[model samples]
Target: MGALDVSKIVQGRQGWRLITCIWLHAGVVHLLINVLCLLFIGIRLEQEFGFVRIGLVYLISGFGGSLMSALFIRSSISVGASGALFGLIGSMLSELITNWSLYANKVAALLTLVFVIVVNLALGILPRVDNFAHIGGLISGFLLGFVVFIRPQFAWINQKRVAPGQETAPVKRKHKTYQYILWLAAVVLLIVGFTVAIVLLFRGYNANDHCSWCHYLSCVPTKKWKCNSSPQTCTVMQQPNTLDLTCDGTGTHHSYSIAGATQDQISQLCNSLCS
Candidate 1:
């Protein structure tokens, strides 16, 4: 029930849709894709980092995705967990980097992961896909991974394993200096990014106003297909015993003979006419 409706969010102040929309999907195909991806990517991360960190990455990343989508795509409704899925992908990349020494076949793993990320992002440019969400989730999760996934240096870990009271040189720091620097920088960036995005969103700033070419990142027109940015609407005219409907997108008209019809019925009829 919680598909993202931009008007409800901006005009009606229903900000909670940003979170609720993540758990909703447009159709069975959409739900299956998200669920399968979640199982494939989430299981390993949850096993390694536990539920808390993974859950945080999921929810925050989903919100980040919704915020970006709201800013750019004011028309139409959006629903799905693609943003959260991208966040997991982003976190995997950052985790590999932050814990580079702990992993084997570093170069090979990095290449494979990079390839996968690039391919998925490329797919976002297609029509009806929200690339902005993918991008926002990725950035949020990448920064978060550095902060939450920092591992202790091997020397520090070995030092802890030493027998009690045994003579051992002190491993001055648990984590490398670079890790600390990255963690701090990532935290600061995350705060600043979220602050700016929220402020812009509440102020009713449309990202499309500033970036003319940004829409191409979400969809590109081709000879066989075209992108539709306008929201679906219908103009209704009612008489005592008949109703007339006109689709705003296509200007197609339909007439129904009925004594009276509720709003939901009218909406369903309009949708059918538009379709």
Candidate 2:
């Protein structure tokens, strides 16, 4: 019914709800948009890489998208398959980019699709939409497709038989160096992605006003009647020969003497406040 209710359903008790939530849309408009995009991209990818492989790519990419969104946008509620759809689009683009000679004509079509989707994604930066999740899904899908789907090159060896002047060629092994490189790159990207997600999770959790040390050292003291009761209060409580002690909302006190402290000392004080 509401965002909170939906969040509860999506978050669930054990967190398995994320998988279903991605498929379940909040409204008709949301369902239609995501379904249309999925149909367009999924059909093309299935044709190229068979149903099973395409399904795998979609599932993994979707998981990556949801994981990123959960880590980064903690307070917001999201439900859509757009992230997976975008992943399919990214896979198609990567395939075309890697083998341009084989798909020269298709490049124009792919580029047109990318342009349209990118414009739509750009619009998402305004509010509601989890553009970050879309981006994570797209990148993960592209990387997975590139790493797993490319054809390998094989070498042949010739052998001669003395009996009847017959010659045969021995099958040679295919090299997988390129695939290994791709996998390595994917791992690196995923690691970086998760790190960003962690950073975003904790961002803006505590406002600057909540830190008494910062208020004491950085914020200018005000003499207004309302200032004393406010969190901005920075009055010195004790005067030592070398330093001045101060108190704020948090009883933890700090000492300051000079007009300004060194960068390292300021950093240490801020860290203590946060801790």
lDDT of 2 by residue, 1-275 (tens): 22312235333533454455467676899889888878877887788789988887787777667765554443446677767877787777766654444554786778786896678666555434666568767877888777656644333222322346665555444434655566578668767865664354335222233344332321223343221233332334333333343333323445666554555655555344322
Each prediction's Cα lDDT score?
A: 0.85, 0.57
Candidate 2 residue 170 C-alpha distance from true site, Å? 9.9
* TM-score for each of the candidates: 0.82, 0.57
* Model 1 residue 25 distance off true place after TM-score fit, in angstroms: 0.3
Clashes of each: 0, 0
Residue 236 alpha-carbon offset, candidate 2, angstroms: 20
Runs with alpha carbons beyond 4 Å of true place in candidate 2: 1-13, 106-110, 152-180, 187-275
The C-alpha stretches of model 1 lying farther than 4 A from their native spots are 165-167, 229-275
Q: What's the distance in Å from true for residue 275, model 1?
A: 20
State the lDDT of candidate 1 residue by residue for 1-275, as single tens digits. Answer: 77887789888889999999999998899999999999999999999999999999999999999999888877668988888888888989998888888887999999999999899988888878988889888888898899888889898999989998897888898988788888999999999999999889888877765665676777676666556645557889988999988765434566799768889888898765544
Best candidate according to TM-score = 1
Candidate 2, residue 248: Cα displacement in angstroms equals 22
